[model samples]
Target: MYVIYLRKSRKDSDLEALGIDVLKRHEETLLELARARSLPIGAIYREVVSGDSIDARPEMVRLLSEVESGIWEGVLVMEVERLARGDTIDQGRVQRAFFYSNTLIVTPGKTYNPAIENDNEYFEFSLFMSRREYATIKRRMQAGRIRSVKDGYYVGNIAPYGWRRVKADDCKHFTLVPDEKENPVLKLMYDFMGNKKYGFQKTCSALTGMGIVSRSGKPFNPATVKTIISNPVNIGMLRWNYRKSQKAIVNGKIATSRPKADDYILAKGKHPGCISEDLYYRANSVNSSMTAPVKRSCRIQNPFAGIVRCSCCGRVMVRKKMSAKQPRDYLICQYAGCATVAIELDELENAVLEWIRNYIADYKVNNFESADDSEQESLRSILVNLEKEKETTLKQRGSLFDLLEQGIYTKEIFFERSTALEDKIKDFDKKIESVNADIVRLDLSKKNRSTFVPKCQELLNAWDTFDAADKNTALKNVIERIDFTKTEKNARGQRHSSFSIDVFPRISR
Candidate 1:
């Protein structure tokens, strides 16, 4: 009995040559060939796979197993190349298997009867041809992909939802443009991401509630949604040299690593986008800022996410839930080897409140009547110097022009001297405008400072009524990074809370 076999390569050109149901057709051809040779065909086995690697082919293994069972005395294929490319190693394995099973391998052009010595060389030649064909097909497909990319065609499948792929004028190349109707989603997504209050899940829920389906009208997936939010292509750029692949080097050469942000190929937008450049930038800033938070299994909001840091280990201290059964949570140091014990959330809250109260009182004590006296003086000095320079430069320019008009100097000489003085005057005018703006700011600052103190005192008085989250926000608004360091006792000493705080008034968290 004879078994029919069929195999097709997944290469691009083969995709065109073999048609869609190439494997099925090849199996049919094998059956017909078996019938023509008056062979009794038992089973038809078909294989559809990429021919890039031959380490694991399930159909190939099944064929060998069937031969070993002695149910089929021979196998018939449409062509010899269908077995495999003429690779010596692969052919050797196939030859050995057939020899052990005493099975005959027949193709349209030639037959491999292990019983005949001369048929062995012909079988080997068939394997070599298949391998050569595979290499040729692969090379051509790769070259086409390179040419397409160079011509700015978007080659990947489906093209990430919000984008629509359209072929170029030539009909051979493709490009991506933002889908007009779906582009509004980008702006809405950015708005949600820019604020820390709305997280990934919340954003998705909000969008779903707004009757905003995905580009395909399906429920929004968190993974796919997150990818769309973070993709650089939204900012009118394509990524090249993005994915890392394993490759061998002949010499002592190092693998070049491309920087993700810098590796994107910037392209002009071919379609209208809903989000502006500024908003896109802000969204990216928000996305990149909190990478560590999203990876955590537990979702406890960290009060001092980017602010608090351990002095010894230099890791951010995160809030940890101590007991799920009780309302007992604590702030724990994030450092892996840190010996610091977790401070109870309630205790830490009280400490922060007390510290803030003390901080406000201390700030009030240092707040003299002329709180910004030095800044005011510096502003006045700068304004006066600028006014004097402007006056001098204008007077010099006026005198030079007068000399030029009076015919006291040649046109060339006059232009040379006048150009030099006019340049200086322009420079001075810019400095004057800058100084005038500073003077106005100083005036505004002086006026605001008087009202600011009372407003700050009012907020502090009401701080006791504020929630933990609100209090954290208020404190961060006033202070930048607080250095929590161990306070050591000196010769005449007093011990502090083991940690000292460094506060900045205007800097951000």
Candidate 2:
């Protein structure tokens, strides 16, 4: 039996320009090739995923797994490169799987039997050539994008909300044009922030009430409103490279990170301003001033400043000094005419800490009978698999060096292959470390009540020694909010208050 595999690479601009019809033609071509070769097609695997990496393609992974079962005599594709154009590890995996299964790779150009030494080398060379081609194309595209950015043209597909894109006279670059509908909403947002002094939530609510939707055609959220207000594009300026971004595939999804601020290029864009520069600055300045911390000479740090909320008005409680002589702080509700009682900082901290200590003690007692043994077992299994993968990668690296020494591989190919394998080994090492950490955490969780009790006690002791910042972090981690009611004076003239504390422990119950 044989399987026919078809893949469409999004990086091929020519193929994309031809539309969905081209994909049908590609499949027909492969099918005709298989029919002419008298190969039996058991199944067909097709996907439209970019890049050569198997991580991005579910069908490729299924095909490789099926091939490994030795159920298929071979896989038929248009060309050898269709199997893989990824890094060395993926290329090696495909080759080795076919070699071990004694399957042939059938292409219109030739049939490659991985068990044959010459055929195996030819297949590897094809994959290497494909990888080089992919790298070159990627580099060219990235260079073009950077050049476009430097030329004051929009390189991205979608323009910011409230803007439309029009091709420049060159027909290769894009310029932003104001969207008559969204641009008015954008100006209204600036007006709300600067002139009306409406905060993000209030502005979002007002926009939603006015039936103004975001780019997704959904009611405007605070985040969407804030992005429009904060963006510099509204002022007819283009800002690029404000932050350095790195992309990685995590659990089959592309995750991006902007680690730190980098050098930024700001240029006047070829677009009319939706809002004046003065309005933009004024709006942002007002937002910053409203959010600034209360001034103090000694910089008094209150752990529960923002977390505490009024039980009556459900508004955030603000920190205020009780008296100049007392030197004590209290969290008071800022809502007008709210009778919610003020909470002394010391009293609130003591009450929260005591509750946490008791909660941890009770959790330890209750969970002592039910350990996370299943999680530990799962971690052990993952660690074993990771170790095996690491060993296989190391062996492959050593084999590559042997091939280099035997003059079977040129220095350039040898270095490229070795570097790729080293990267795989590094990724495996990271996974192993992460698994080990999980196992350790599970082990601690499964410890006896006596052992667990001491850990909780140590945590309590650590709180006493923590600085104001650390204390604040600890409070935020364990307690969600502390609500207070008005204090009452007893017949004996003693003041008493009640609190409703919302505790959210870090550990699961």
Candidate 3:
């Protein structure tokens, strides 16, 4: 018995445009060929997915498995390319599976018996030709896509949240037009995060509460909100080739890493921007300031959720409520083997507040002697030095251009020197900004601290009124980590514990 294996080419856009009927015709043609050859077709394995790799197509994998078991005497296909159009490794696997099973590969034009050396040679040669053709077609398609992107047309299928995909005038390329229904929601999201200082989770909750669903008709998720906010496409910028390399099939799916800043292809898009560049960056900066694990939605407003670590096992301490009727929250070590005893959440909060108050008292006493004017003068001197270095780099870059024009430097050398100078200028620019920020902070410190202590005290006093996200942010800004360990019980059986808190003051930028 013979199995008829059929596959539609992934790169065949013409066949896809003609619709499913064209693929059906391919099946009919293969059936006709089998009947003419007088072969008993046991089962027909038809795959609509692109036959790029053996792992990518499930039907193909099943076919190979049955063929290797010696269940079928031969395999019938339209062509050898239908069996494999992948790299040498996949092609070799297909060839060896047939050869070891002593199966015959029957195509329309000829019959290839893998047991025969000559036929096996012809089959291998056909696979090689198919691989070469696949490479050629892949290159042409990639070149077309690059050209399409450079021409300011949207090359991807799915448009971003605020945009709708539309066919261009030429009917060959696509463009993005603003989706009327979603644009208003997108604008509101940006305003909430950038202008209102709302976190991603809070903003997502607000949108979902307002009955704003995503394209899938599901409630907005934090990941979806983050993707929309951080996307440069909203600012009328197209970013392509952001992956460092081509995707590799890992666990039967495409996986790739982000490319470096220099490798990205960024261009001004033809579509109108939904948010200003300033708003985009500001929202992204706020999102970036958050700790990694804090991006999710938290049900309980525990400021010390991720910050509190188990002293014994170094695992994060989780907040567990004892009962629904008389709820008493306690911070317990998440690890099963950790011997750390549970501490009441209220007791922990009180300890943290006391530490903050003591820190403020110490700051007020020690900071009085250090004059802010002297610090400002020092920062100003550093800023002046950075400005001079920036000027020198700019002059060096200007000289390189002149040297290139005067034939004093080759194109390669000029580019090398220019890149070095450009990098130097960027470094100087960052240092200058840092110094200026320090100067501003120094000037503000003198006046702000007079009211800072009172404001902090008020924040701590009303901490319960703040939401979970706000409390988390405030704790992260103030405290680095709080170590807790239980002490031995006294003769009266009274247990006592020691708390060590590491405090980091919030720096204004």
Candidate 4:
């Protein structure tokens, strides 16, 4: 009994471009060899993908597992090297698989019998040579990539946001072109972070408030906001080997990871920059200097943790618990050199309720529409367009691999196109999701309109009985933030003082 194992090699890519079916050719040759010797072919394993290790390649793993069972008399391949060219351990594993099974390694050139000492030694030597060749090819590719980066070409698999990857008209290399729609948003992201001195969270929130969304049509997140503002690519720069790939054995399986590295090649790119270098540097400085988020506590302390801010310094007002002598909780601005005076929490809460009542009056006067049939109809129209976009993106994605195989796109270009298409498809899906959510929210808003005033009144009535966390959550559901201004602190500790409170409601009214 015998079996055939097949996998495409690196050289096979070029052959594929030449319209040669390398696998089929190998298969025919091997089949001819089998017929000449009158050997019976029991099974055939064809690997449709490429991977660096056995675990990464499914068919190869199954072949080795079966070979280890010693069920076959021989394992036929186009070349002995095709069986294993991963690493020394992998080659040794392949060597041992045949040696222990006493199976012959069959190729078109010659047959290697594991039982013979000379044949086994020769087979191992062939596998080692194949590994060396593979390593050399990879090293060359890496060197080429680095050279491309140094020459101001964009060799990355995906283009940075606000930019599109395009092959340079005058040269063989690829470069970045600004995306009209995304370019403005990318610039605004920088403006928010650098010029306005907003943190990632605030920048994302501001963008969402302005109805700016990612290609996926979802609200921008902190991580995405940071990536966009901090990326030197927006300033016409390229980063090479920023995070180098690290390979290790994890739980008896090969795993690859790329960890953040401080040292990397940062060169000026050929692409036109979207933002100024000053903006780029400033945003990064703010990003690094910002404090980390506080972890959630077991018990809630402040009802207005996020919703209250110091009007002077623009920092979130912190809850300061008084000692036994003071007997009060004050929301204080913690910024150094800030002139903002702290106000007692009791006084602030009462002011917030008064403001809520005023807001209810204003809402009624304005006669704002909570749910509109026309708005839902508009959302439905947007949803249909998003679905169409997703369908087109998916279709483009389907042909990307074929283009790569046909040599229509280089490996780098293929990756960029694939990533862009995938991102577009994901964005469309999210946009569709967001539209659906809007429709549902409109339906909920109809029910919610009558409940709003009662909800606020109930909270005001039950303020003392409610838990700190419960109060905070209730306030956050309606209020965006409460700006507090107090320039002069009272010489005498007064619960009631000349302090001002400005409540920013989440609702439009």
Candidate 1 lDDT over 149-240, as tens digits, reads: 65556666677556788876677767787777766786688788764545555566677778787766655645455677766567665554
lDDT of 4 by residue, 199-288 (tens): 776776688778788877766766567667777888888999988988888898778988778888998899878788888888777743
The most accurate candidate by TM-score is 2
Cα lDDT listed for each candidate:
0.64, 0.75, 0.77, 0.82
Query: Residue 35 error for model 2, in Å?
Result: 4.2
In candidate 3, what are the lDDT values of residues 32-87, reduced to their tens digit?
98888888889988887764679889988999999899999999888898899888
- Model 1 Cα displacement at 469 (Å)? 33
TM-score of each: 0.47, 0.61, 0.57, 0.54
lDDT of 4 at 375: 83
Candidate numbers, best lDDT first, in rank order: 4, 3, 2, 1
Q: Please report how far candidate 4 places residue 189 from its true position, in Å.
A: 2.3
> What would the TM-score be for candidate 3 when compared with the true structure?
0.57
User: How does candidate 1 score on lDDT?
Assistant: 0.64
- Could you give candidate 2's per-residue lDDT for residues 1-509 as a string of tens digits? 89988876545567667665655777788789878878888998887776547767899899999899998999888778878888888889888889899988887788899888999999889989988988898789878877777777876688888888999888878989888887888889999988888876567667777877777776675556666788788998877766657788889766777753556767777676789888898877654212235454544366775677777777676665556654677766643335566666777778877877787767767664355766688889989999998999899988997898899999999989988998999999999999999888767555544354464566588987877666776666555566655544224434344666765444444
- Assess candidate 4 and give its lDDT: 0.82
